[model samples]
Target: MSTPVTASADALHRAATRKAMLRLIPLMCLIYLLSYLDRTNVSIAKSQLAIDLGLSAAAYGFGAGIFFLSYALLEVPSNLAAHRFGPRRWIVRIAITWGALSAAMMFVRGETSFYVMRMLLGAAEAGLFPALMYMITLWFAQEDRSIAVGWVYTAPALALLIGNPVGGALMQLDGSFGLHGWQWMFLAEGVPSILVGVLLWFKLPERPHDARWLSKQEADLLTARAVSSGTGGGHDASRITLAMLKQALLKPFVTLIGAIYFFNQIAFIGLIFFTPAIVQQMHVKTPLLVGALSSAIGVGSVIGVLGVPRIQRWLQRDCLLLGLLTFGLIAGSVLFLLVPTLVVRIALLAILAFFGKGVLTLYWTIAMGRMQGFGAAAGLAFINMLGLIGAFVGPYAYGLAESATGKASSGFFVAILASVLGLVLVPLLPAALRRADAEASQSQRTSARVMTADSPVV
Candidate 1:
């Protein structure tokens, strides 16, 4: 503890890791921002698309929800390919393909074409999120993981923040170059992803060791940290045997977290797809004002992105924070029902957005801490794949509800129930993961125990 050399080395390692984060995270954020924007811009286009293509709310929801089916089907295969061929190459390929498909929405003449294009876009974008998560696992230590993930998680919120207003403006381009405003929005928003994919190709490295920007010492230290299977840390690929992979796929945490994410995603994605329509119903007729109002929800989501960690620190418990966030979802849903005024409803929606998007940081932090290497690739994909069912159900069911009741808010009751179900599973997180205070010391002891158990006779 008193050694100067040891302290210096630790400081250098931290610096290097910070340097890597500075270089990579911005690009990652931009890519994800585009990804989220392209997927959700359809929400803004919903009304116009309905007018142009004669798409019912149910049809629009079905088309939007259908993306997850293809995405879920391909998630594992994409992650596995990333592990084999490198996340850099695979992610770039995915970005390009999806961006092209997203742009092609301009060509969809009817329901069948709309569904086909959405499915193709989903298939193309399948593994990008988990692949990026895996990359984070490889570069950052467990303790640094939350911050890294939190930063990345903000992209979607930022996408909404920026995309909604911009999409609304693009929607105003109603007859520009003889294309519909929705068509213009699709074409305009989709190109950035392809550009960002190209940027990632030259900018990103295959591994920490391969990063030209990192000093050898920094690179080596980061690499060691990544592979260190300390008490709370992740395992190296060396431990990723077939049995271990199978066990990982079957882990209780994976299934449980997947289920939890499934529930939350239903609520979150439902809100994303329908918030504009809801705003339109609020007597906000102007698309720009609607976009601006919708963007306020993004502002709330960003606040949650920033607020979650601060709240986590004060509470000194991840599990408690998780519980509270889920409860926030439930409360937001209840408020959505009780509130009658337009301003109050908008404010409450933001609060709901805060909880909805904020919970993601907690979810991934817990999930990433428990997995690594090939198992992580498979496990993360599996978890996300399962959660995507909720993504599908969120919009589709909301559409059905909207059609049945002629009210968008009628679908929020489902969110209330789903969040409640997720809350019930909160106490089941492993004891060590639940308590922040125990993690460092407990991890050290666990690491020591594993070493002792594995030691050969001297």
Candidate 2:
């Protein structure tokens, strides 16, 4: 702690890491923006698409949530493939495939075709999120991870902020080239994904060691730091045994981690897919206004994302903040039901958005802190895999609930239940994090971990 020369080298590492984050985060974020745009633009297009194809509300919601089924089915295997091929290649494959399938939605003339296309898109895009999370761990240190992740998470918000207005505009292209406006919108939004995928082939490096922008010193530093951060110590390509996988499988924290994300994603999924419907039901029919309202939600999400690091910096107790945020989310959900005024509903939605985004953003920090080696990848992926079930449940159940209740926000009751489930799981986290932190610290100090090649991700 007192050596000037050693301190200077430490300073150099931090500077290099920050600079590298600036370089990498934008590209990563842009690719994810494309991913979110393709998936969620369907939300923007749903009203038009339902009318054009004669889909019932339940059918539309079914189609939307059905995407996650295929996503869940393929998630682990796709992540396993990405871990084997490297993100540079695997991500490009995911991108082009999902984009092509998404664009093909222009041909969906019935419920069957709509469901089939959505499922295909999910299969094609399965591994991108978890792979990105795993990659973040590789490139950024524990200290800088929140910043890198914060920027990356904002892409989804940006997608909605920008996508809604733009998708609304594209919706005006109805009947152009004998296609419905929703068809044109789907095709238009789908193009960027293919373009982003192509760019990534040339732009994204598989790892720090492969990055042209990094010097040898920087690359070595990052690689060393990653290994030291419970990445199986030094065996980056080591094989994981059945026993290791079984042990990771048996961790109670793994189930709790999945529950946290499950609740967070379900809250968001209900909002993302059904907000337009909710707005329109309130007698707000102008498409542009609808899109703008959607952007308001994005504004809330962005604020929440950016605030995570800042609040952590200020309070220095992220776990406490996480607990508070979880409770806040439950309160927001309850208010969503009781609030009747439009303005108040808007504010409550924003509050819900804020807590929803914050919890997920901060959650992985705890998750990663507790996990190590091959099991970490599995832990992350399994969390993602199970989380998609919540994604599936949120929209599908919302549609059912909306139909049953005969009110737009009525479906929010289901979201409340999900969030409550998540809250109940909260007390379990601290003790679990303690166990994980102890395990991770011990693993790092003893250099006793081994990285599993083909370690599947979320």
Best model number under TM-score: 2
**Model 1 lDDT per residue over 1-458, tens place:** 66998899889988988898898888788898899999999999999998999999999988999998899899988888888788999999999999999999899999999999999999999999998988887888877777888888889989889889999999999998899999999999888888888989999886788898888889888878876632123346444567866876887777778888899988889889999998998889988999999997898888888778667657767777888899999998898899889998889888998999988887777777666577678888888998888898889988998999888888798789889998998878655344533654686699899999999988
TM value for model 1: 0.92
Clashes of each: 0, 2
Give one digit per residue, the lDDT tens place, for model 2 in 1-458. 56997687688789779877887888889989999888888887777876778877778888899898899888877776666667679889989888888888888889999899989988898988878877887777777777777888899878867888888888888888788888888888788889899999998887888988889888888877776666534224347566766776567778877877788678678778888788777778877777777676777778888887678768877667877887887788788777778888877877777787766778676566555555656667778888887888788888888778767577678777877787777787778777867876786556533444345666
Error of 1 at 278 (Å): 0.3
Give the Cα lDDT of each candidate. 0.85, 0.78
Q: Which pairs clash in the backbone of model 1?
A: none
Model 2 vs. true fold: TM:
0.93
What would the TM-scores of all predictions be? Answer: 0.92, 0.93
**lDDT score at residue 268, model 1, on the 0-100 scale:** 85
Residue pairs that clash (backbone atoms under 3 angstroms), model 2:
130-458, 174-181
